[model samples]
Target: MTADDYVEQASEIFVLSDSFIRIRELIDDEASTIDDISEVILLDPALAGTVLKLANSPFFNYPGKIDTISKAVLVLGITEVYNLVIAYFTTEAFKKINANQAYLDDFWIKSIDCALLMKFLGTSLGIVHAERLFILGLLHNLGELVVHQLTLEKHTACESNDINLLPWHKQQDILGFTFGECSAGLLKEWQLPYNIFAAIRDQDIDDLSQYNVETQLLYIAKRVMSKNQVFKGQSLDYSSLVTKEQLELLCLDKNMLENAVDYCDLERLSLLAILNPRASMLY
Candidate 1:
């Protein structure tokens, strides 16, 4: 297999919902009115239920209950509502297969932790379109989900005792790509915005010349999220992967990084409980 092979396979992975595709198209076209967006959202009953649940969740902290999609949109702002909708739609993209439940849970927990931290850091830095930044953070690792799914059949062949040593990326390499590369390709095929594609692709390391401040913030946030002591085993050092010049370009500092981690730690636990109450209870 080659990079092209992996890209082709990734492109073939069916998105489960046509409504999701339409919603992405509408938002990308800059749907301006609540009515216009609401009409699209109401097409999916599951999505409508999620929007209402999210609006009333502690994340939003609405004083009163929100019953209608239109009211939820009004209270949450279109950008926020859009972000929440996407988050809900995409949250289930990763599901545990025969992989160790503990490992899968931990991976998702870290992903959510990193995403929330990125969102907080982006907002605190006064980045324009912070909500989009949050969405990027949330969806940045979706490529990993794709890779895991694509290779599931192969992965199951490993002896149970040998599973830990399976070298996941080698499978990707054999299949001719990395999940990051495959994911970026998928995002491009999906026609998502340039910022999102750039954020995920460049997240491996900082390249000041290619990406702007917004993209750089994502790089920093991913690193910070990875380094959380909870994910110490999987964390990579951004300083080594990124150049000093790139760090200087982004105006990154230890203080902001620390603040982001502290905020994400609290919020991620809450989000986990909200998103997967049963798993939260068990773990």
Candidate 2:
């Protein structure tokens, strides 16, 4: 099946709950207030609890307690809160997808690694709404799951386990499109923000000049996660994978990238505990 076919099939099966839809509508409406969004969030106890947990989690590092949805909205801002809500619900929506648990676990770990790195790096660069970058990194590779669900036979062939061979090229060779593009297609179908989907759509490209800063940041984060030898229990090397020009584009140097990777290592486990249902079960 093609990318669109897989996306269409996945959308039919993996559906977002109505509460999230309502929350999106509320965020879009100019008349909606914190209490208005909080009222809708309160109707879903699990979501509300998750929101509070994330507000208190190291993700935000807020000092005081964010005990209520209204307060969470106030502290996290409506857009950041919406970013978290969608990130939460999107993961929840795909929790039970038919795939090997081990494979899925690895996929999610790498995704969270990329996400935390993106958030850290974006924030370091003073980008607004860096939380959305986290969501972008988290959701970037979901098309792999979609493909695994729809066309199980092709899924294994799509993996580029070798550090030298980029996964997107492998996917393009096998599936006629990169998983990033397929992921973007799925997000577009869900009516997500244009920037979110578009960045994912072009993240794997060689050229970074045409895309926005968010997309460039995502591209860098993805490369770090992809080429991370340390994550695979090997020695580190960025000399070949990340170019000097790329680092300069973001006004970042090798040390900052190293710090971002270290930051991800520090934060990945905690964030995964909150985001990954399978991992959360262990706690």
Candidate 3:
């Protein structure tokens, strides 16, 4: 199957939920009031519940639980609320995929970690639309999700454990396109800003000279997340991929990178606990 084939196939399997579609349309139309937006959110009980749950999650760092939708909006801010809505909507696609739970869990953990790290870096850089950057980090691996789903359908006999053994290009070849490319295409189709599509499309930090601070932060965050020495079976030299000049440009250093990783891990664990409230044994 080609990338276009997966795109065509995904269209059939993944219809954007009505609530998400409505919210996206309203936001695109520039409906400026909280009530107008909140009404659209409240149309789907599941989406609303997810928002409130996420608002109370340790990820938000709220002092106390927030029960109401209006309070969630107030606490998380308008951009964050929109991000949560999209996240809740997009998670259904992952749920429908037959990928291994452990792989999916790790992917989500890493993505969330990247999002937290990007948000931190964006704030430090005084980047506008920090929350949007966070959302981009969270959704950056969406193409992977699509590829995994489509591959499962094509290779039903293939075991999950064998997936990692396939070369990166081979995996993409089998699936018709790499996740990075597909994710960019999908986000573009969704009418997201050009920078977001570009950032997701090009995960390489070296190729990000033209991107703004927000995109640069996301690009670096993805590189950090992808640097799994143990999982990849090779020591990733971040120095080679991310030069000293680039780090200085971003106002980052070894210490800052280390601290960001630590902070991101903590946030990921907190969010995981919220997602799996009963998984105390796992923790």
Candidate 4:
């Protein structure tokens, strides 16, 4: 079956909640105030508490405490808070799926590692609203979940864990399409913005010169995730894993690459627990 077939089959299970839909609508509405967004968020106590926790988390590094949804909206800005909500609700949505617990745990760990790296790299490059890249990095591999859910027989083959062979390459060899392409297809089916789905669609391409900076960042972050063997507990040479040309794509240096790796290593542990779907079950 084609990626679209798989996406169509899994669409019902992978969805944004009505609360997130309302939050998106409010963000798009010109007349909406901080109170407006805050009201929608507070209706779901779990979402409200998570928002406040994220606002106070090291994710933002704000100077003072953010005790309420309204304060979070004012400090993190409506757009950023919207992105955080997307990140939260998206992860939470996966809680209902009946997949292998260990596999899901590893999947989220690698995803968060990629996300923290993307945020750090984007922020270092002085990109605006770099926080949004976290969602991109976090969600880039959701197609793998789709494959695991819909086409269980092919999922293991598609994983292609050999370090020498890149993941997208192995996916294409087995499934005739990369997981990134499948991921992009699923996001587009969800009616996400062009900037988002488009980047994920093309992230597996050999050359990223023609794509946007976010796409380039995804490529770099994925490379780092694979090379560092994140959550695999093996230390690899950072310099050897990332090439000069790859770093130069974003005008970043080796030091910045090392720092990004370090940042992910330091932060991913806490975020792994916070973002895991199981953790959200307590809320």
Candidate 5:
């Protein structure tokens, strides 16, 4: 199917939950208070639980526990709470697709890894609106979900795995374009933000000059997460995933990159344990 076809399909068939829709509206309203947003979040028990977990997680580093959605709001602030809601909300949206639990877990773990790093690098590198990058990193592979839902069974049944085609190209072979392209299209339809959809589309661009720092953050997060996911459940140096050139682009040195790599692992499992408490396979 064409990229347009996938975008149309996702817009029509892949519905965003009501809670997410309200939360999105809440973020846009200059007058929306923490209570207004928290009331909406509390309506969904699942979203509340996840939001509380995130607020309590090292991601926030709140001094005391965040037991209620309202407290989570107070601790995380309006902007941060909104960002966290979008991250979890978008995750639930794609989980409705037909990927099996095993596949979903893998996807979840990888995306979380990328997201954690984006938050880390964006902050350390002094990028404004780092919270937005967290959302970008989490949803970076969304088009992969669309393509996987459409072609996964057949793609797996194919006995030959092309050694030469890059993963994104292999995706293009299966779908009309890469997941990044598909993600941009869907985000555009959702009317989220221009820079977000624009940066999502720029992830695969080879030339750094073509991307602003925000898009570059998205690109590097993907690269590091791809490598880190492969190295999961094994003992290996993921520091190699952070190269000198990638560091230079971020105006960071090797030490910061390595620290971020280490932090990715340290936090990935902790976040996974809380997010996917039932999935023992992550062990």
Candidate 6:
């Protein structure tokens, strides 16, 4: 099927929460207050529970407990609370699918880790609207889900557990397009930001000089998370993985990359647990 066909099928494949749309709009409004966000969230008990659980989780690193949704928004900031809720919602987007449980778990863990790292990296670089990167990173690989679902229908022989080749490469071979291209189509369908669309479309650029720093940062964040998941034993040698010009372009030195690795190491587990609580309990 063509890219348009894939996107068209995606709308029917996943059901987005209406409250998510309202919360997204509410957070974007300049005059929005914590109460407004709380009210929107309180409309859905599931969303409210997710927010409160995460707010009290060690991931937030807050001392006292955060009981109310309003206080969660106030302490976590509107953007953060919004990102967490949306990110969690995205995690639940594809339940009751016939994919390998292990593969599905890795896909989400890596997505959340990369998105969190993107936010952290964005803040260090003083990039505005960094919270958007959370969704950007979370949804960056959504096209893969579309393709996986299509594959499940016997459209192709792509197995969810298959890892002989990278996912994007396999997608390119099977669907004649990379997940990046597919994600671009889906993001456009959702009417997300132009910068996010551009960044994901170019997140894998090998020629770092051609793209902006934001894309490069995403590439780095994705690579770091992938390495952490796929390479737990060995050390990450950025001297070889990251080019000198790329590092210089992004104003990132060895120290920053190392620090990010350390941060990932410390936070990756807690984050996986908090973000995938159900799966966390199983494993």
Model 5: CA > 4 A from native? 128-132, 153-164, 230-246
Question: What TM-score does each of the candidates earn?
Answer: 0.77, 0.94, 0.81, 0.91, 0.85, 0.80
CA RMSD of all predictions: 4.7, 1.8, 4.0, 2.8, 3.3, 3.7
The stretch of ten residues in a row with the least summed lDDT in candidate 1 is 158-167
Kindly list the per-residue Cα lDDT of model 1 for residues 1-283, writing each as its tens digit. 4545655676665343677777766766754577878998998877888778777865555699899999987877877887777677566444433356765666567667767777677777777646556677767666666656667654344212222342223444355444555566667776666766777776654355676766677666665664553336654544533356755676666677677777776666567775555456544
> What is the overall TM-score of model 6 with all chains considered together?
0.80
Q: Give each model's whole-structure lDDT.
A: 0.64, 0.84, 0.69, 0.81, 0.74, 0.72
Off by over 4 Å in 2: 229-231, 234-236, 280-283
> What is the per-residue lDDT of model 6 for residues 1-283, given as tens digits with 9 covering 90 to 100?
8877888888677656788888878877889888988998999988888878877865566899899998988777887787677667766667755688886887777777777777677767888756556667777777777777776653344333223454455566777777777777877776555776788887767787888767888878876666566544566566535578777888888787667767655666666776676555444
Summarize candidate 3's per-residue lDDT along 14-104 as a digit string, tens digits.
Answer: 6677777777777667646777788888888888888888888766667988988888888778778888887777776557777777777
Per-residue lDDT over 1-283 for candidate 4, one digit per residue giving the tens place of the 0 to 100 score:
8888888877788888899889888888899899999999999998898888778878778899999899998988987888779778877777777788877877787888889999999999999878878888888888888898878888888765455676777889899898888888888877666887888888788677788899999988887787775324555555544567767878988788789989987877667656775633322
Instruction: Give the per-residue lDDT of model 5 (tens digit) for 100-181.
Output: 8887787788778888889899989777656557778877878777766766764353212232344666666665577899
In candidate 3, stretches whose alpha carbon ends up further than 4 angstroms from where it belongs are 62-65, 152-177, 193-195, 229-237, 275-282
lDDT winner: 2
Better of 3 and 5 by TM-score: 5
